[model samples]
Target: MSKLLKDYLAKSLQDKKDRGLYNEIQILDGANGPMIQIEGQELVNLSSNNYLGLATDDRLIKASQTAADQYGVGAGAVRTINGTQRIHQELEEAIAKFKGTEAAIAFQSGFNCNMGAISAVMDKNDAILSDELNHASIIDGCRLSGAKIIRIKHSDMADLRAKAKEASESGLYNKIMYITDGVFSMDGDVAKLPEIVEIAKEFDLITYVDDAHGSGVMGQGAGTVKHFGLAKEIDFQIGTLSKAIGVVGGYVAGSKDLIDWLKVAARPFLFSTSLTPSDAAAAKEAITIMTQSTELNEKLWQNAAYLKEKLAALGFNTGHSETPITPVIVGDENLTQKFTKRLYEEGVYAKSIVFPTVPLGTGRLRNMPTAAHTQAMLDQAVDAYEKVGRELGII
Candidate 1:
């Protein structure tokens, strides 16, 4: 490397270290489940987004293996080329049927689905009203769209209304689109889509809901839009096959015309190779299971309620989470990190969310309760939390 390049990186890394902002990645030695092994320690894991515990489900694994054996591995080309297979078509149809849309299109990831879809629909002539706490992917997608973005307060319907009215009356743009997450991952709060849809109708605004975290966890495994019973009204319903689906990829479900347009206009689907056959097969199986039964979803909510109630009873402030995600709020960053470290040492693997990821003083330990976790596992985790809170004087 050039001396200047090396020197620059060194200085930046050193700065992060000095400010305790550097993140160190851990190596998972096995499959990600309720319990995981990292560096010879077995811990009760509460840090995964696998809400339904389908990642290691035997049915998904068998489906993936069957597909791999028949189709080999990679797609070998982009979706526009020879890459789009029968399985891809099946998955798209499944997603549309599941999401209650006319059609659907898949992308390489949830991130790029946002990147490609937002840019394809809204351009420099358009304005996007985005929630302030939408995911980073949405922010990047909005930036790429070249549209004038107006930030609405997080889940504040009144602010959304005021902004929508202002943007519409100003006549500064030809098209107005409102984009937000169905569930905010950090705080685990569900979006107010009913109010959003109402406002959209009044202003003729196009609505987009990125339900990445809500895909298999809400609406009997459909999503948040369906949960609110507004599937027909929302314009773009985006989701991930990775999170709750326990595979890998993203998709946008919408009208046939919109999906047709995206297939041609979205750059990622045109340029990037499609998902490997195994991943696609696994995702298809996951959706099949999700649609067929509510057992997993029911169990997930039960576990979430149990953990949330236990933590609250123990005096940890789990800020307004309406979903399975539980954040144990610890205001100080250093204290939060130390608390996580103690939890890890005591056999629970919850991680700390400090400055920048969250507002500086609102550091937290984000806990994800999956359906695979038994009551015993949860009790053990609570015990660890109790012990650590007392030791740290946090409770």
Candidate 2:
């Protein structure tokens, strides 16, 4: 390596070590279900985004296997070529039906979908009014769009309206778009979509909602757009199959015109290979499950409510969450990491979020309660939390 790179790497490693921020990765020996095995010890899982427990569902697994057997492995070429398979079209149709959109298009991953879709529509001459705490993918997408990005205060409709109006009245941009996360992943707060839609209408701005974390947990599993009854109003509805859908890909649901435009213009969709037959088939099955019943969604909410209540009663600050994503606020980064380590030792696996992922001094332990977790499992996890909390003087 060059001297500069060597020095930078050495300093960065030293800095992490000095602050006790160096992370030791642990391997999950098996499936990421309600319980996971780490270092040969089984623990209650609280760090996954498998909200509906569909990641290991038998139907999804069977679908994937069947597709692999029928269609072989890869798509074999970029989508612009002849890579698009029948399963790809089937998956898009399934997603459109689930999201209540006229049509949908899939990308390699949620990150790419954001990058491809946002940049494909918005340009340097436009302005994007985005929520302050939107996901990293949205941030990257806006940056890639080369749009004048105006960040509104998190979930504050007043701020959004002010900035949007200013951007519109200035006439400096060809168009204005308001973008936000359907569910704030870190804090678990739902976006104020009703107010946002009203603001977007007033300003004549396009509305985009990235529902990566909302898709299998909200609106009886439809998503935040459906939760707020704005399915047709929102211009862009982005979702991830890797999370609740139990597969690996991302998609954008919108009007037929928008879907057609993206299919032609989005770089990732055009240049990158389409999803594997197995992944596409599995995602289609996941959508079918969501459409068929609300059982998983109900179970997930029940577990989330129970966990949040118990944590609050124990004096652990569960941040302003309206979904299954729960955070145990511990201000100091070192203490937060230590708390997570202790919890793992006590047979519960939760991850620590510190600076960079979040802002400085707002370190936390994020817990993801999934549908697979039973009441007995949750009770055991609560007991472990109590023991670890007392041991660390956190409660």
Candidate 3:
């Protein structure tokens, strides 16, 4: 590396260490579940996004194994070449049915789906009005699209309307789209999809909702778009199988024509190999479980409510969260990191998210209470919180 690059990196590392901003990574030695083994120590885990505990489900495992035995591992070529298996088409159909859409297209990852889908639809002449606090993938997607990105204040319908009007009146673009996350991952706040749909109708703009954290958590596990009863209205409904589905891949659910267009135009879909047969089968099984029974979802909400109530009663600021994703707000970045470290030492594995992930000073220890967490496990976690809170003077 050049001296200048070396010097810059060294300075950055030093600054982070001096300010206690650098967080140490922990090795998870076992399966990631409500309880996990880290460095030979078992801990109550509150850092996973496996909302329904389907990641370790026996049915999913069987499905994956069955598919692997039949099709073997890996897709030999990209979709346009020959990688699209029968399982791929079946999975896409399953996703469409689950999301209540006419058709769907899958990608290698949620990030790639965003990157490919956005650029395939919009261009430099078009403009995009995006939620200020949308996920990084959305921001990157907007950039890749070459659209004139206009930021709207988070959850502010009025700001969105104003920007939509401005962009519409300019007449410099052929179309405009309003995009937002169905559930804000950081704050756990649900998007105002109804209001957004209304605004889109008024402005004749395409509507996009990235339901990465919303799928299998809302609308009886259908997702936030269906939660708001706007299934057919929204143009783009994006989701990730890595989270709720307990598998890996991302998908965009929309009209038949849109899916057809994306299948041909989206670079990732055209160039990258399709999802492994095992992953596709596992995801299909997950969707089946979610649709057939609400047992896991019910357990997840019960646990979420229990934890939120206890945290509130204990005097920690659990921000404006309406979902299972909870944030124990400890403002200072240094304190947040220290707090997470202490929690780990106390046999609870929750990670601290600081600046860049969230705004500076909004540093928080984000907790995700999954359905797999037993009452006994939660009790132990609560006790740990109390002990750590007192020691750190946070409560």
Candidate 4:
């Protein structure tokens, strides 16, 4: 429209292209499953966040349809308004039970859950010790909180302890909080929660864990905190229902007091419309499925292990990942893009992670292998990877 706005947009686009940071998005023609149809080509899917394949489970679909029939498609208003429906309350209760927490409160999405939860509890007078490799939402949330944020090196307990000690003894802040991703989405590394809990107790610092990528993939589906048996130690446990829960929404699980506070103080919960009845019902059913059996979880791990071993044998450097989130670290940005293209051409759909998403010079293909992927699917993906890796000389 305006000359200045047009110039800025043009320069930004040109810069991204010149730097090989701009990614052309591909549209999926059908369901996001183990095999996906993109641009009329069927490919073995390895980029979805559906770790347990519950997104297309018949049970969750039935629950969603039943709730949609019983209730309207939408919540109609914010929770404080007329949106605190029975289904919504039931979903929260199910989340609390799944997370092994005293209570829980739901949000429209995981990104805002961090945004709202952090700002609601911490203030400018408080200091938050955060992991350097945390999700962007956590970083934005800390900024929104107006808290003095001290970054700790990725999973470095020494740095965390030192920062916590300095902030605690400074006598400059009334409260200090420690926050991290239970399972980092990029590096796929698990946070050192046990050592963190010890550090939190040592400094009397508040603890928060956003397990957005770990809910259905870790701790036997309870999450990373419960996986480490530290449920009672962490003050706040946040997660997303869209990824592993196979629905759509976010939540914070903690004490009854914490849930009550979020209900009153979190701006998103107060302003944004509540989740649809179908989503709430489906999410609850997904949680129920995870709790009743570990079948999906076990299958997911098996697939992850099988794929990782295959990729390693093929000579692709998978940077330290403990979860199902596999990364093929292809150092250069252009090379990363080229590798992704090769994989896509060979019938695998894995995306490239580059500058702004991951640090510069660390561009990679972030693979997400889920429970729905059969041995044959994984084998097919591995065959594609082998062809691409040898062609690129990345092996």
Local distance difference test values of all predictions, in order: 0.93, 0.92, 0.92, 0.94
How close is every model to the real structure, measured as TM-score? Answer: 0.98, 0.98, 0.98, 0.99
| Candidate topping TM-score | 4
Query: What would the per-residue lDDT of candidate 4 be over residues 1-395, giving only the tens digit for each residue?
Result: 99999999999999998898999999989988889999899999999999999988999999999999999899899999899899999999999988999999999999989999999999999999999989999999999999999999989999998889999999999999999999999889999999999999999999999999989988999999989999999999999999988888999999999999999999989999999999999999999999999999999999999999999888889989999999999999999999999999999999999989899999999999999999999999999888889888898
lDDT (C-alpha) at residue 148 in model 4: 97
- Clash count in backbone of candidate 4: 0
Instruction: Identify the runs in model 3 with alpha carbons over 4 angstroms from their true place.
Output: none
Off by over 4 Å in 4: none
Give the per-residue lDDT of model 3 (tens digit) for 336-385. 98899899999999899987889988989999998899989988888999
The 10-residue segment with the lowest total lDDT in model 3? 17-26
lDDT of 2 by residue, 1-395 (tens): 89999999999999986665666688999999999998799999999998889999999999999999988899998887998999999999999999999999999999999999999999999999989898898999999999999989999888888898889899899989999999999999999999888988999999999999999888999999999889989999999999999889999999999999999989889888889999999999999999999999998999999999999899898988989999999988888889988888889999888877788789899999999999888888899888888888988
lDDT (Cα, 0-100) at 181 in candidate 1: 96
- lDDT, candidate 4, equals 0.94
**lDDT computed for candidate 3:** 0.92
lDDT of 1 by residue, 58-145 (tens): 9999999999998889989999989998889999999999999999998989999999999999999999999999999999999999
